[model samples]
Target: MNFKVVPFKALTPQQLYTIYHLRVTVFVVEQTCAYQEVDDLDLTAEHLLGVDTDGRLMAYARLMQEPNQQARIGRVLVNPADRGHGYGQLLVQTAIEQIQQLWPETTQIKIQAQHYLDQFYQSFGFKPVSSVYLEDDIPHQDMILTL
Candidate 1:
């Protein structure tokens, strides 16, 4: 898979459409959660897309720089048909490297991850920083990775 890290303004129309479509398909439809998927945050995010050889988006996430200079990774997802292929790990590892390149001053990365995936993110050095809480009816916890 090829990874591309682009600012919101730099994404092409088709890329932007595909990102939202995939997010809704998995986060909303597949997960059966009914909540707003496209929030105002996307306007300021740097999107990371992992595209396959066929030019289809198989994995994605958004990187955001917080006011305190910490980086946040959010909206992580792998295509339903493409799960169990290790694309998700590659997508996030690429995002971490890209965020460091984009913001060398950043010393910490944060994520609001689903409770069940705590171990997965933990493998990337993220430690739980908050108790599990319900967000949009799904349990999630805040995690941080100090660089």
Candidate 2:
């Protein structure tokens, strides 16, 4: 699969549509969660898109620089048809690399990961930093990857 990562403003309209559709497909329609997916974060955060050779959005994530001087990664979503293809890992690693480049002095990366995927995030050096909490009716925990 061909893959590339770009910032939010750099995303083409087609890519934006595909990313939104994929997020709604898995986050709301499939998971039955109804929270607003298009939050204000996208305006300033770095967006990463993982597309296939056929130009399908396989996975996506966002990186944000917080006021507390920490780099954050969130909104991780993998297309249902693309799960188990290691696309999630690739998406996240790409975001982390981009964040590192964007903020070289940043030493920690934070994420509010779904509870069930704790081990998956751990594989990327993210450790549980908070007790599991409910967000948008789903269990989530704050995890951090310290660089």
Candidate 3:
């Protein structure tokens, strides 16, 4: 499971491709979500990618800080075969570190997480801040991790 988590700007073309392919495989094909994955945020985001020993992308997510004083963590995805490997948890921890590095004064990390995974994110210190709502036809809730 040799992996490296690099910022979005530091990602190579191949790395970006591996990420999108994995996202499409899991989010689109597996979850049946037909929405667009590339929402124009990647250009300014700091991506945390988990590449396996063979250079395959096992997991990925992005981090961005908006004007509302909220640092966002989104676009979380893990390859189907890679589930239960703890890569997603590592990706999140790395993303949080990136946010802290970029905005040390920031107090909260926000995420619109899928409803069923609320407890999973909670284990990492995230607290639900919004009533559950549907996003892309899937139930989701807004969660925030306060630093």
Q: Candidate 3 on 1-147: residue-level lDDT in tens?
A: 544556677888988888888778888888899998876898888777677767877777887887766799988987778888787788788788878888887888999999999998999999999999999889999999989
Q: Write the per-residue lDDT of candidate 2 for residues 92-117, one digit (tens) a residue.
A: 87888888888888889999999999
C-alpha TM-scores of all predictions: 0.97, 0.91, 0.90
Which scores greater on TM-score, model 1 or model 3?
1
What's the CA error at residue 126 for candidate 2, in Å?
A: 1.0
> TM-score of predicted model 2?
0.91
Worst 10 residues of 2 by lDDT: 1-10
Residue 48 lDDT, candidate 3, scale 0-100: 72
Backbone clashes in candidate 2 total 0
The better candidate by lDDT, 1 or 3, is 1
Q: What is the lDDT for 68 in model 2?
A: 61
lDDT of 3 at 109: 93
Each prediction's Cα lDDT score? Answer: 0.94, 0.84, 0.83
Q: What is the C-alpha RMSD of each candidate to the true structure, in Å?
A: 0.8, 1.5, 1.7
